[model samples]
Every structure is written in C-alpha cells, then in structure tokens.
Target: MRKLALIILVAVTSQTTWADAVSDLKNYLSSTQSLQANFKQTVTSQQGKIQNSSGTLSIQRPGLFRWIYQKPFEQLIIADGKQVWLYDPDLKQATVKAMGKALESSPAALLAGNNQFERNYTLRPLPSREGIDWLEATPKQADQSFNSVKLGFSQGQLMQMELHDNFGQTTRIYFSALKINPKIDASQFRFTPPKDADVIRE
Candidate 1:
C-alpha cells in the first residue's frame, strides 16, 4: 500500500543519513595528520559549579599532542609519542610518564592518536543539531573514565566535543579557527624541563 511504501522510504533515508555521518567521521579521522585549533572549554561540576578555560590545541598523528592553556592560568600537557609531560609554570614543576600509561583513560588521546576507532568504540549518528553532523561514541571498555563522547562536525571540520565523566562532571569544548593537516614541527611535541624546575618521573 501507499502507507507501507512511505514507511520504507523513510527508513531507508534515515539509514543512509546515519551511514553518511559515520563515514564522514571515519574519513576525517583517517585523513587528518595534523591539526591546530583554538578552543574554549567549559566544565560543569556535578554540584552545578561552572568553570571556563580557553586554550590552543595542536596534534600530530600517531601519538603526539600539545594542549596549552593560556588564560586564567598557564599549563602545558605534551605527549611526545614516547612520554607524556605535564608542566605547570606557577609551580615550576613537571611530571613525566610513559605515553601509553598516560593515555589509558584519556579522551584527549582519542582525539589525538591514530586509534582504531571501530575496535575501541561503538559509533552512532546523533540527531543533527545546529546544522552540525553529530556522532556519539561509546567505549567498548566499561571501565572508561568517561561515560560517552559526542563529536560535532560542520562542513567536514571538527567543531565541538562533549565528554561526560564517570564522576558526573561534563566538559564541553568548542573549536574555532581549526586548521586541519597543517605543517607541524617535530619539536612541537617535545618537552624539556625548565632550569631550576622540579621534574618528577613516574
């Protein structure tokens, strides 16, 4: 009947739309070798307190990233493929850890590393919002630090990410002036402790 045909058409259209979103995400992840973006991060605590931070983010594929927080406070988190370093200028201290261990439960790692997405996450298309194609990713491991992550893309560019932590805190990051596949110097991911600073290795 006409009603049955219409139902089938709607179902097919929905499926195609979902597939397109997933495909777009996969292609973006596979093609992006390096990226730079300015970001604003908002964190809401379980008790409803809110905090805001603005930062610049840079990432090179295969386990390299630098997150520089410049406003409110200055902090640097750098992963150099082999090790991860956390530098706090105010404290004059740095902590170093093996990269694998540092990325174990990190959502940032998911964004920066060349991870096998399908192997680690179940990806599904979220209803489009604000003219952005949204994808929701749930970790295969039940012990993940965050409950789930949502990624939003506009015109094939990553624009936003939302992470919900196990502790009920939610962090939302909005990206602006994003540059994909930009040339990044090798030294960008490297970190050296400053003179007279405390360095702790784990």
Candidate 2:
C-alpha cells in the first residue's frame, strides 16, 4: 500500500518537444490546481500474482492530497503539507510522518504538488497505444524504488498510470470520473486517528 501511495506521489520528470501529448500533459498539470478521481489499481507481482483494488483520490497543488482505499479494505492516506498520515481502519492503527521525510523521492509529489515537474526525470513521448496518448518518465536518480512510470492521457485528462518497479513487479492504475480543478474541501487533507486506533508517529 505504501508502494501505491509512493507511486502516486513521485511525479517529477524532464521533457522535450517531441509531441503535443507531452505539452498537453504539462499544460494540464500546470493549469489544474485541484482534482478528484476514482481509480482502479492492479498490482502484478514478480511471481505473477495479481491483486486489485479501487479507490478515490483528491489532490490540491503544493503539497496536499487525499487517497482513500475503498475496495478490498478501507484505508486513508492524507498529506496536509507538513505531515502525512496513514490510517488503517481494519488494523485500528494510524501512522504519521513528516511530509518531507515521507515524500523525499515521490514522483507523484511532482505530479500533484510541484509545478516544476520537469526537474529530475527523463520524459519521452511513447507511441500512442490503447487509443491513449502516453508519456514515460524515468527518474534520473537510480536509487529510487521504481524504475519508470508511464502516464496516459486523453482529451486533456489523465486516464491511466503504470509504474514498473525494480523488483520486476508492475502497478497499473486507471482513473475515471475525473474532475479537474474541482473545489475540494481543505479538511479532506487532514486526518485524525480513531479513538481506539494505535497511533505511531515517525
């Protein structure tokens, strides 16, 4: 689940003038200040085992986002600019960490928070596949967990994402019902552990 959160957080990349797809994506990110979407995720392990989950996510620029897992279990990951809180309702536990410590190398962080995403990644426009404009981002730093990430867009909206990890596992995410620049409540980015939950602060 941390992988899922990490994948969504690390969104940095470098770009070239290869195609409109690349420019369109950069434009969309720059213009979009907030968004909400439903997502379906599939993780395929190196051994070929697959796990599926569904969730809803909301993001506001400059270090604020909420990701809620609603299928297969219920969990919440909320980052309120200063700190990140991970709460697992089933386990009755919540973990908290400083945002800088938690998202040091997050790709999604660049995607959602940092407007200057073209900083630490090599971005290439991939051949359109599945009728979706695709862009690939590979981190310049080799010490990261994932090898590369791919983003699929259509009609100026993000439709999908794929992350290939160093361990040979792949995580694919499809987004739907996307609301770009939607009004999201600021409270959603804040989290409070349940009364009975064990709280761990890091």
> Which candidate leads in lDDT?
1
Taking the tens digit of each residue's C-alpha lDDT, what string does model 2 give over 1-202? 9997776554321222236577777787779899899999999999999999999999998789999999999989999999889999889999998977336456676556675556667888776776678888888778889999888888778889999999999999999999889998899988878789999999
For the record, the alpha-carbon RMSD of candidate 2 to the native fold, in angstroms, is 9.7
Question: What residue runs in model 1 are displaced by over 4 Å at the alpha carbon?
Answer: 1-17, 101-105
Model 1: which residue pairs collide?
none
- TM-score, one value per model: 0.89, 0.87
For candidate 2, the lDDT comes to: 0.82
Q: Candidate 1 on 1-202: residue-level lDDT in tens?
A: 9999999987886676677677778777788889999999999999999999999989998789999999889999999988989999999999999977436445665678665777777888777788777888888788778899998877777889999999999999999998889999999999999998999999
lDDT of each: 0.85, 0.82
**Which pairs clash inside model 2?**
8-108, 9-107, 9-108, 9-109, 10-106, 10-107, 10-108, 11-107, 11-108, 14-121
How many clashing pairs per prediction, in order? Answer: 0, 10
Q: What is the C-alpha RMSD of each candidate to the true structure, in Å?
A: 2.4, 9.7
